[model samples]
Structures are given as C-alpha cells and as structure tokens.
Target chain A: MISVTALTVSRGERLLFRDLSFHVASGEAVALTGANGAGKTSLLRTLAGFIRPDAGTVTFSAADPAEARAGHLHWLGHLDGLKTGRRAREELAFQARWAGADADGIAAAVDVLALEPLLDLEVRKLSAGQRRRLAFARVIAAPRPLWLLDEPFAPLDARWRAALGLMMQAHLDKGGAILAAVHDPLPVAARALDIGAGR
Target chain B: MILFRRELALAWSGGGGPLLACGFFLCLTVLIPLAAGGDPAGLRPIAGGVAWLALALSSILSLERLFERDLEDGALDLIALGPAPLELVVLAKAKAQWLAVGVPLALTAPVAAITLGLPPAQAPLVLLSALVGSLGFALTGALGAALALGSKRGGLLIAVVVLPLFIPPVVFGAGALERATNGLDPAPALAFLAAWVLFAAVVTPFAGAAAIRNAQG
Candidate 1:
C-alpha cells in the first residue's frame, strides 16, 4: 500500500498540481483521471521515486522508500524498454530474470501473452500491439505488489484491451495495488482520482 | 550478472560495436605519419603521444551512447527499479564497457604504436599501459555519458565532459611509453596509469548513479 500526503509537483515555471493527496490500499486500483499536462505521470513517477516532489511525502507501508522502489513495484511507462537489437525472447528472458522471476514465471508469462511464435524476431519487427503485449508480459512474468502504469492499455487492440482488463481484475483479486494514469475508463473496476481538479 | 551480460551484448552487437572504435583508432594513427610526413625518426619521438591521443579519441567514440540509449528507450527506469542498487548498475555498465570497448582497443594499440614507429622493444609496455588506461577511459567515460543523458546535443556534451577526464590516463600511459623509449624506468608511469584507473573506478559508480537519478527526474 502507498500513501501520498500534500504532494506538490511543478515542472519548469508551471504548476501541474498542488497539495494533492491520495492512497491506494491493497487489492485496489486507482485510475488517475485528468487532462493532458496534469500531474498523473508525475505522481506515479514521484511514488516510484523517479521524480523528487517539490513538496510532500510518499510512503509505502511495508518497506522503506528505496526498498519499495527497487523490488516492490512494476513501472510500465510509454516506452516499452525493449532493445531494438534484441530478440523478443532475449528481451523477455533478461527482463524476467532482472525482475527476479523464475523460469516457471517466464513460462507462464509467455503462455498468457502468446509470445512463443514471436520469440525469435527482433523487437523492431513486432507490431505495435505485439510490442505492447511484450511490454506487459514482463509485469506478468514477475509478480510485484504494486504496478504504476502510465496508459496501460494505450496501444492494444480491443481484444487485448479486454484481456488486460481481465488480467487487472486477477491482479486485484490477488491483493495487488495499481495506480494507473489513463484517459479512458479502466477495464476493471477502479476508484477514479481526479488530479488538478481542485486547482 | 545478467545485466552485465546484457550490456556486453548490446555493446557488441549494437552501434557498430568495438569495430568502430578500433577503426577510428587505426585511422587516426595512420593519418599522423601522412600529415606530418613519413619520417620514422620524426614520428618515433611522438609515436607514444600520438597513439595515446588516438586511444583517447577512440575511447570517446562509443561513450555517447553508453547511457543515452537506455535513457531514451526507458530501460533506465526499469533498471533503477531492479533489485540491484543504482550504483551497482552503473558499476556493471562500466565494467562491461571496459570488457567490450576498452579491451579490444587495448589489444589493437600495440599494433598501432609499432606502425607509428614505436620501438618493438617498448611494445609490451604500450600494450600494458593501454590496457590499464582504457579502463580509466571506460569508467570516466561512463560517468561523462551519464552526466550528458537527456541533453539536446548529448554526443557533443559527452565529448566535452569526457576528454578532460581522459587527460590523466593519456599522460600516464604515454609517459610510461616515453620513459621506456628513452631507456628509463617505466614502472612509475605504469603505476600512475594503474592508479588513475583505480581512481576512476572508485569515483565513477557513485557519481554516475547520481547523474542517472538526476536525469530520471
């Protein structure tokens, strides 16, 4: 579980949000709803420890800030993080191992994502939805308590989008926490947090 | 270990690998005699200096991408989230750079030195100094690369930041070869080169990690 108190973040001379406070408890998904230029991604990054907040505190109940960042969460940002030169299998294996997943975990992820046929191709050769699926596969391969997703379903087609919704439901069922930044409705049930609305 | 292996593979297969640096190094060495006139006697005195200069420049060739690629592709974010501390990740990357880029250039340095009229008797010292000096280059180069991440003209920024850091190793490595060429004791200079490498190894990981974290924000 994560909590933010009086979180204020600014970029350059512009203030994105101020005095924002929210928390996502276990088995919950908090969809961040706001217009572009709002502090949704910034909030996620702040919690993930990528951005230092101008003012406020983000705390994880189970672990210290550093430990929570290092091993407790999955961050799926806009970029897929796959190396263009690497084979899909190579990328998946490396990411899975890097996340401390066992071989069985990787096998299960491959099965769920239907990644077997695309394993040998270079990442650049994969289609957009395929690449997005590959990106989401790492999250499945490694079980983390929290996922800080920025537009989790952006590039996927309808079928994959629905599939990911089901996956999110399963994750919530297992007591994981999610803080996602999105423009559209999340496939599963989620409490909406409107950033910058007070301002 | 997986991170190290992945870095090494990326260094080798992507962005022309060690081949590009080696080619740039060889070309620089070859151009020296042509530009200065083909007089072995004239070139011999500065051969060590020229080779060291070429080595320094070649080391800079691949540094621009060391951290830039990861940052641009978002791998850096995930890397920071991994179980290893960010400092360890920086250390692994620098170590992999030494193995991938530094070692190949070190192996090719003796040949370049000898071709530039360095005495074959001093070839072994040239090889040893280059081996150690390139380690310094790789370590400091990673720091420079990390510092220049997300900048508009990152390659230029990396060169500006890294070339100054190269001065110590270049001085020590070239000084070692010069001493040997003059039939003096080269041990002290070689020791200096090793010390520079140790200093770089000590300072780069923490500094580079900080730079990386700053870039993330």
Candidate 2:
C-alpha cells in the first residue's frame, strides 16, 4: 500500500537514519521497532508527509503522493491532538467533518473506544489512557487504508491494549495496512522491522 | 464549514481570544485619558489615532495563535492531510478569527472612541474605518503568524513582522477619521483603506500557505 526507497532523515546536526527502504502492503501490519531516538517516529512522519526527507521518495504503488496524503492515511502522533478546552464529542465531530467521515463512522469509533460517558467532559480532564483511546478512535472513525501510528498502545492498560489489538486485527482483516512504532509486543501478528538495525 | 465552526468555538471559549482582545481594547481607551491628563481638547484630537493604534496592537495579540496552536497540537498535519488546499484552510482560519475577534472589536470601536472623547459625529467613520482596517489586519497578521510558525519567540516575532504591515492601514484609517472630524472630504482616504483591505485579502492566503508549508518540516 505504501513504499519508501533510499529514505534518509536527519534532525538538525544529528543523523537519525540513512538509506532506508520499506513497504507495507494491504492487509499487512509492520511493527517498526527501535530504541529511543532511533528514528522510528521520524520514519512515520516522513511517510505521512509531515517531515520532508533529506533524500529519496515515499510513494504509493497504486496512487499519487497527494491522494495518498489526503484521505488514505490516519496519523496518530505522540500528542493526542485533542483540544484540551473543547469537549470530547465536539473534538471528535470536528475531526470527523474534516476527515470526511460520516455519522456512522463517528459513532462506531466512539463505541469501540467506549467513550460514551466521557463525551461531555473537556479533553483536559480525561485521564492518560482515556486520552490515548480517544486518539486511537480516529483510526476507526475513518476507515483509511494506511495508519501511521507512533507508540500506538503506549498509554492504555491491558484491557484497552487488548481492545486496540482487536481493533487492529479487524482493520487488517478489512484490507487496511498499518505502520506502527512499538516498544512492546503487539497482539496482532506483524512483520517487525527494527529501524536501529536498518541504520 | 466544519473548520470555521471549530475555529470560532475555540476562539470564543473561556480565556480563549476574542473577549480578551475586547478587554485589551477597552483598557487602551481607559488608560489613554489618565495618561494624557484631563485635557479634553488634546484628548479629543488624538482619540481617533489612539483607538487606531490600540486596535492594531490588540490585533497582534490574537494573530500569534492563528496557526501556532494547531501546529503544536498536530492538528496542522491533519489539516494538511485533508483534501482541501492548504491555502483555503489558511484563509478560512483567518476569516473565522476575524468574525470572532474583529467583528466584536469593530462593534466596540464607536463606544471606545466616545470614551476617548472622539466627537460623536466622527464615531460612524471611526466604526467604518475600524471594520475595514481589521480585515487588513487579520489577513496581514495571518501571514506574519505563518512566517513565525515554528519560532521559539513566535509572539515577539509575529509582532515585529506584523506591526510594520499594520502601518498603512493605521495611516489610512486615521486619515479618514481625522478628515471627517475636521469636516473635510474623507473620500480618497476611505478609498485607499478599502483598497488596502482587498490587497491584503488577496496576498495573505497564497503567502501564508507557502509559509505554513515550508514550516511543516
């Protein structure tokens, strides 16, 4: 679904990764593993078109870069990206409209994440696990083909982690692709790529 | 459509932006009198000018957040990933901000002008100029904010970048008010002010979008 060739990413004076290449196909999940500061997030950002690469190209085999960018991927970065002052429901609705998701998508995401009771509260008041779950819901909110996740399961407890695993399995079953940076084991069977080793 | 509503809600929320700008506008009107002593003649002459300056300065306060906040929260990335052109997103945000902050500030101008001893007859022109000038301010200010997007000193940088751009509007607006108050023809100055707004409106979206796209790295 997504491919990169001869990708090199650097942060200021330090080089994070060099001459990297990888691909994730439909119905596949790639677990990007690396130690801290090993360019895991950088790779995800680069593929998601957030960071410009120092070298090489990231392309979709079936579509143009712009189409791949517009609605093909859902990125869950380090920050939850929720507005602290806005209510949870309001934030989700805003994102839904922007992401071109419909009412059913929003409701399914809210239900899967079990966010019904938390809808009225401001985002700032939500706990860490809840916050992470709220962000995770975006993947479900819009059924995008690609997901660029940075530490996808970091803040959730075991149960929520399991729920996330189930969601990933379901998404993969539906022919979606995932590129996630993980520090721990993911319940879904994934092809692991260690960024540090590639470096 | 959704982006506009969300921007408006965020701007007007508690401790958000628009109300704070109005408060700042009121403070400037109140303080100038105390600073200048109780000389009605001197105060009346400069009232329009002081209001123009305050409006320009207060406009800076909100512009800093126009893009910076979204950039920080990762929302900018999401917006960029959307189907809409980034230029339209930049323009929509500035328009929403103007509706939230500029409209309220413009509406409050006549009252603020009255408090600053601007002749009651000049209040209408003061209000008109404020409305037009704010459109210029909002557009130019968005460009400045986009330019200073990732800077550590974003607020100061935006002020420095935007304040200079504000001068033309301030000059034209104040000229319109002064001429009208003096019972002279203010038509030429008003025309210039209107032209400046249209110019800012056209230039900002393209320039601001490029600045924002460059900063994403």
Each candidate's fnat: 0.81, 0.61
Pairs of residues clashing in candidate 2: none
Tens digits of per-residue lDDT for model 2 on A18-74? 889888899999999999999999899889887888999999966798788888888
Q: How many residue pairs clash in each candidate?
A: 0, 0
Candidate 1 lDDT tens digits, A48-158: 999988998999988999998888899999888899889999999988889889899999999998999999999999998899899888899999999999998898999
**What DockQ does each listed candidate score?**
0.88, 0.64
Query: What are the runs in model 1 whose C-alpha is more than 4 Å off?
Result: none
Give, for candidate 1 chain B, the lowest lDDT window spanning 10 residues.
B119-128
Task: State how far residue A117 of model 2 sits from its true place (Å).
Answer: 1.2
> Model 2 misses residue B69 by how many Å?
2.2
Q: What would the per-residue lDDT of candidate 1 be over residues B1-217, giving only the tens digit for each residue?
A: 9999999999999977699999999999889899998888899898999999999999998888889999999899989999899889998999899899999999999999999999888878888889899889999999999999999999999999999899988898889888888889999998888888899889999999999999999
Tens-digit lDDT track of model 2 for B79-108: 888878889888898888888888889988
Whole-model lDDT, model 2: 0.87
